[model samples]
Target: MRTTTAPGDALGVLETAALLRELTAGLISAADFDEALAQLVRTCRAAVPGVTWCSVTILQAGEPASVAASDEPIRALDDVQYGDDGPAITAIRERDPVFVPDLAGSGRWPRWTARALALGVHGVVSAPVDIDDQVIGSINLYARRPGAFRDRQQLTAMLLAEHAGLLLAAVRGRVRADRAQPQPVAPGDEEVVGHALGVIMTQRGCPAPEAREVLRGASRALSIPLAELARRLVDSVARHHPG
Candidate 1:
């Protein structure tokens, strides 16, 4: 997104630039991800009259997920949006700001549309939030009146999304160490396995399969090679560990 530039409002530009600098510096120092995300939506809604409410859904590990929201009717959309597991997922794949002028008539994400319709919000503008080319999350703006967001409002939403990404990445980087689910280690470590195999090629003087097994055994025992033991094993002159 193009940053706010080409200004007649010198003070506004300075203030905006200052704020951007401050935000960039603190992007990774947010207090809490959930609170920060909710605040982003709140800030968006307050800044734009048409947007009375907002919500944030994130892609966690290639799957759609909702982090936080205002907890109104739109709150229900999370269970499905969590993994792009539902229709609302369309908003995620859509790069341009989506202005749902009328949720009831909007056929996109049928289930999501139905839920939002129940909330009494006539429209919403959702935009993808990106940081350093990575799409971190999306911001959804809700309007009490039908067809509230104009082209200008949509543009503002995109601008809001940029800052949102900075804040979230910062907040999430910290919170993730605590809240993220555990990841498993692959059964066989690639580097050690390959290194062991290479070691066997020189010491075993055998075919690939035999070398692989020899390396496997040595690795499992975590054996340290001794001179005598190393000599006992056959050696291919070309194979050498450069000191």
Candidate 2:
């Protein structure tokens, strides 16, 4: 199926360049890289005309997980990850952009197509976020209408994904260097944080980075320290989903 954008519906090259500049600036000034990733998804949703939602799927430590999503009801991403056949996974695996113009007629990953349709997502475009030769993750955009993403939209998404990949690479490098230095943590706090991350991973079916971001968000919302919030979450999970 062919898709076209109205004259005003698509961003001009100059506008696109300005938006990318803003994103790059934001990434440079962001206090936390994970939070920046969350912001990146939100920016993607705003920059793309037909995008109803956006998410970032990172493959780190041999685990693939949706680390940031613009919407809360992103359970479909989990299905894609589990099935290993959706556009997001394919984009990262192949290190290329994957566009599903019409999910209903795609004839690929039937389960994922059904789930996405049920979730009101009919179109998708996923672009691999790469750093050098490494495929770090993917930037996935979803649309509510079939064939919503046209070539222009795909190109914009690809550009954004490339910018995100560069930022991620810098952030990962900084984190690795930090890890080499001595850091202090309160007694038992690390364990509590780990347990809380695990609980979030189990409950949300997201990756470790995503779970950590969730914890950080909760901490900010509740005006509590991260360790304390983690402790609370661990206790709550134990009470509810006791193993």
Candidate 3:
């Protein structure tokens, strides 16, 4: 099926860039890269309007693995795709976005389509996430309604996948470096970021991703690393509202 082009306003370039920047900073601030990746898929599920489930695939131990998923049960959907010609696999193979606007209308990947439809998934979009020039994976989004991912939605998913590729590269580099020289990590660092996110969300009445963007924006303006900024924020909040 042909992919539709998104209009200028469907998702402005500036907005897309901002999202990528925030996501990059948030990933860098994370204490555990794997858990951060899991959080990323969750954030994507929340950020994208029509996405019913989201998953990220990457090579682990020389084999494809679902590194992160929005919901644990949704991993079943990804499992069906791993050994089949599913959209996610095709997207990685072709290094392009694969769009299945309506699973009922398409005969491709019979196994995946049937499994998806049985689970109330009617639309799927898979975009390739390049780990490097040669290695690639995919970020897959599933929707419950047909035609859920139109021009704008598809573009959003693609942009997210593009940024996810960059983040994965960072993760891979970190893993290699850790294997060479182990680093000590602080306890409760993850909770610091989570607490800061909660504070931001409560203050702005926004979602976790939006709060993350706000935190990133603040970190940028203050010239502080995201993790440090989050720690400071949590400390300040505790000081003022001491229990």
Candidate 4:
């Protein structure tokens, strides 16, 4: 819950605590709660000095995608979707944190390591973001220098990941409550599900039927109920289009 710095460093425990409080307050009060996730990664970059880049990787239907990144270069995380050997993948799959103090010297994930090295990333840490014992994603931190991340930085990242998880859970809860409310002819559930399907259709450039099918596929792959998956998708859309 605290981060330390050298005597003259600009950041310290007080600053870190203030950042955490700000993030928590924003997530709790924001009308569009999902947008708070993007803020989470940005906060990570600011709170941790060794973090050169930050990204949030969301796992849906057994597929992982980077939903928010601090910089354009960090978008290379999309490539990680192709393989299962990267730090983020490991973190989510194992429900644990993975830290590569020196990406270039690490023996694991040769392909991902090479790609990260090419991007001037020499160290990385990934922490699982979970809710109710289920790991839904990870927060990945990248550094430009070897051994850039130490135990303190890892602890800070983990704390941020915990906050991110709490925010996501809250969003999901809201969506579920909205869907559960009583309604006339067209139930709230169906309405929200339809909206979610339309969102998928637009984002994936597909038709309504195809988007519904995509949702079903993801639901089955991730072992999440269709309605729950729909809620998550709707939440995601709301985050991007807060207006």
Candidate 4 residues lying further than 4 Å off, grouped into runs, are 1-13, 31-34, 132-135, 179-243
- Superposing all C-alpha atoms, what RMSD in Å does each candidate have to the true structure? 12.4, 11.4, 15.2, 11.6
**After superposition, candidate 2 runs with Cα above 4 Å error:** 1-11, 132-135, 179-243
lDDT head-to-head 3 vs 4, winner: 3
For model 4, name the residue pairs that clash: none
TM-score of 4: 0.65
TM for candidate 2 is 0.67
lDDT of 4 by residue, 114-191 (tens): 778888989988998885443288889999989888876777778788887887788767755654443233365788
**Candidate 3 least-lDDT 10 residues:** 176-185
lDDT of each: 0.59, 0.77, 0.77, 0.75
For residues 29-88, write the lDDT of model 1, one tens digit per residue: 456765676666555655565677777777665555455667666666555565333323
Q: lDDT (0-100) at residue 160 of candidate 4?
A: 81
lDDT of 2 by residue, 1-243 (tens): 244667755668799888898788777666666777877887888877889988888776546644688867764464466555777778877888888878888898777777788888899999988754433788889999988888878878888988888887787677546544433448878998888899999989999999988887776566577888888888887788679
Pairs that collide in candidate 2 are none
